[model samples]
Target: MNMSWKGVMPAMTTKFTDDDRLDLKMFEVNLKAQMKAGVDALILGGSLGEASTLLEEEKSVLTRAAVDMVDGKIPIVVNIAEQATKAAMNAAETAEQDGASGLMILPPMRYKADDRETVTYFQEIAKSTSLPIMIYNNPVDYKIHVTLEMFEELLKYDNIQAVKESTRDTTNITRLINRFGDRLKILGGVDTLALECLVMGADGWVAGLVCAFPEETVAIYRLVKAGRIDEAAAIFRWFLPLLELDINPKLVQNIKLAEVATGIGTENVRAPRLPLAGEERAQVLSIIENGMKTRPKLPDYLNL
Candidate 1:
């Protein structure tokens, strides 16, 4: 499958049963909804998907389920976040065999590798699998930045094709375009910066809020790319509060809550992580409710 890598792709969250087992039914439901809403791709086992906590078997199950659910409607990319190069390589190979079309790889977790080590880690994984790779560069949460210089070296591989830009530095979008030109397809990895990044020449958006409000998310990307800034801005303004939820440390809980509110999925998470409660839950609910009540109407062209 040839993905354009130039539109809205949600870094989907993993759904769990009440017993915390992989909720394959709800997972398929969410995947179907995203496809129906016309998202460009489905990314499973991302940080948003609780990849850190998932067992190897669980990741394979999610990948296989996504591939089965999407069936060729869109590409399914699995995220690989491992501490060791060989582990990352094994994960990449497994994803490919499980029918994933691509991989989004982060640098070594726990111990932040230096620039050279980071480059080596990615290259080894790329060499191990034929699947296309998107280097995840989120310094804020992951703590290791895939610097421009490092990217220059890493992009030499044929399979290392794209970058998920989440440095939270808006200017880095322009810098990426200037430095790499068309060698790397840059996807906006932050929710709040989606429109700005698109306007600044980002090829696509790897969104978080889209897991809840897919139509609105795709509408914003389409409108902005179509040069309808005012229309896109209207949606963005209405979406800002909800999009803000994506940046919080408790984003998994917040987004899962939004999913439940929207009738898509549940708020059940795994061990060491619990559902939102008390005042915190109420505050997030307020923001989501306010957004829903005042949701912006899409233009006729959007047809949502």
Candidate 2:
């Protein structure tokens, strides 16, 4: 699958059973729904996918499962957030070998790599694999900003193809395009800012809430690109409350709760990250339920 790197690509939640094993059954259920809703790609083991908690073997399992299920329909992009340069490189290699079409690489995890270190890390990973890479430039959360200057240096590598723009500043999309032109693709990584990012000419959306609301997410992207601003804005307005859930510290649990409300997944998170409980649970549930109650009848935007 050639990665267009342009469309609604869900940063999917990793489904787990009551025993906390890889719930391939539920995973497949979500994957099929995303594909049916016309997403351009499938992204595995991302922040929303609980990449930090997943074992390396488990990431491989998720990658292979997604690869098998999607067949050749869309690209399966594996996320690599390893702290060590060697480990990140190895993960990139493994993802390619396991049939991933692309990778979303974060700046060195835990340690705040200086600009030089950050560029070197990405450059080395690019050297290790022929698969295309999307640098996850999430400085707000990750602390290591891959600045435009860093990108100027990193662009020499042909495999470093895109950036998952999560800086929370939508203008950075224009900044990247202004600087890099067509040299790099930009995918919106902030869920709340997705529509704005798209309107700003982002190549695509690396969506979080799409784990449960795939159709609505895709609808917004398609309508915006199709020049139906009012229609897209209408759906986005309805989606605003739920989309905001993706920015919270407990976003994984919040999105899983949304998934449960939509009848597509469970709220079972790994240990250290329990399901949203007490007042927090009720508040998130209120948001999810309210959204469900008012879930809009989507137009046939895809056909349009």
Candidate 3:
């Protein structure tokens, strides 16, 4: 599964010790469970992995754990988003050396770019790695939207194979699919929007919710692939609300909660970010507990 650009690839949470060190065992358990559930890819060191909260060393530890568990059964793509090209390149190189099958580059943080810098940024990262690169174009979260022209330019890099379109706008997915088509892998980066994205010709999901519900999410993708759009839509109905919650401000916390509530992993996260607590925590747990109640549990999710 070299650089799989399709199906449910969960943005895995980077587990942390109470002292804020990387929890390698928890990470390994999560990765193994996801693979057993048949996820198409393991997206580690990503938003849900809380990439911004991690030090380079911690990310390295997490990446190593993921690649080891996946064992090349599926593509292992890590998100490497640093403000400077060198830092991003280091992360990319480390992931590649550690056996990652691909890289997903988020725009540099804190100072999301206008058009020119955005194009240059991707070009620099693309130049640094031999691994297949997936550009993460999430303007809402990063305030940096790589335009269609920018994508066309990035397309020149043989290794710049995909774009995780997290724009939350189906129209943009349709626009990109119309213009680029098979030239680029158009992945749905948001879980709530996956079906709409698929209908608009997006090839797959770089999902956050899949960490908690891998089998269900993969089932949706398989249905879509089998041309059972109605069945896929049926699954989406149970999934979309939780997926929509993931797009909310509490996304990171909620995703961790989904993992914790369902016993796939812990909700422990590092600071600058904090775990959900008080009523906020209760509400998120309630959502996971309540929603998961109606359907039979998705395999790999711990049963109540």
Candidate 4:
């Protein structure tokens, strides 16, 4: 399947059993819900999907399950975040074999590679896989920014085709468009910045809050792209509070809590990561509850 990479793609959270195993059943439930809500694609095992904690074999299962569940309704892309060049290549190969439609790759994990090293790392992985790649460029969290010059170097590779732009510098979105134009598809990576990025011509959004509110997320994207800026802004104003949850350091727990509150999944996460608790938990729940109580009604066109 050829994915346009020009609309909403949820950076889905990995659903876990109460005892911390991959819950394929509930995962299918969530994927189906996103599809029913009109999401354009599904990206699994991203930072939002808890990729760092997941085992290699678990990623395979998740990839294959997503391919099966989506069944070509939308493209399923797997995220590869590894420390070694060879390991990243192997993961990319594995994702392709597992039937993933594409791959979202971060630079070498842990060690901050210089621009030369980052270019080489991405080049090596892109050479190894037939899957289309979306370079994950968030210097804030990943510590290695894929600068414009580095992207200029990377643009030589045909498959290094997209970017998950989360530099927190919205200006960089316009810069990317000015520099790369049609060569690279830009997907807004920060939930809080999705509206601004889209307004500034980001091709799509790799959204986190969509896990909890798929329809609203899709509605915002559609309305914005359709030139209904005022309608989109109204929903975005209401969404900003919940969307802020996606940028927190504890985003996985925060988003999962919202998922549980919204009745799509659970707040259960693996060890080293626990469910939200105490005052933080209360505060998060209050935000979600308040948003739910005063949710905006979908426009008549979107109601379809």
Best by TM-score: 2
Q: Residue-wise lDDT of candidate 4 within 82-113, one digit each (tens)?
A: 99999999998899899998989999998989
Residue-by-residue lDDT tens digits, candidate 2, 23-103: 999999989999999999989998888888898899999899999999899999999989899999899889998999999
Candidate 1, poorest ten consecutive residues by summed lDDT = 295-304
Ranking by TM-score: 2, 4, 1, 3
Better of 2 and 4 by TM-score: 2
Error of 3 at 242 (Å): 1.5
147-265: candidate 1 lDDT, tens digit per residue: 99999889889889999999989999999999989989999999999989998999999999999999999999888888998899989999999999998989999999999988899
lDDT of 3 at 28: 82
Give candidate 3 regions above 4 Å deviation.
296-304
Shift of residue 254 alpha carbon in model 2, Å = 0.6
**Pairs clashing within candidate 3:** none
- Relative to the true structure, how large is the alpha-carbon lDDT of every model? 0.90, 0.92, 0.81, 0.91
My TM-score estimates for the predictions, one after another, are 0.97, 0.98, 0.93, 0.98
**lDDT (Cα, tens digit) per residue for candidate 3, span 129-248:** 889999998888889888898888889999999999988788998788789888899899888889888877788888888888877888777777767788778888988778877888
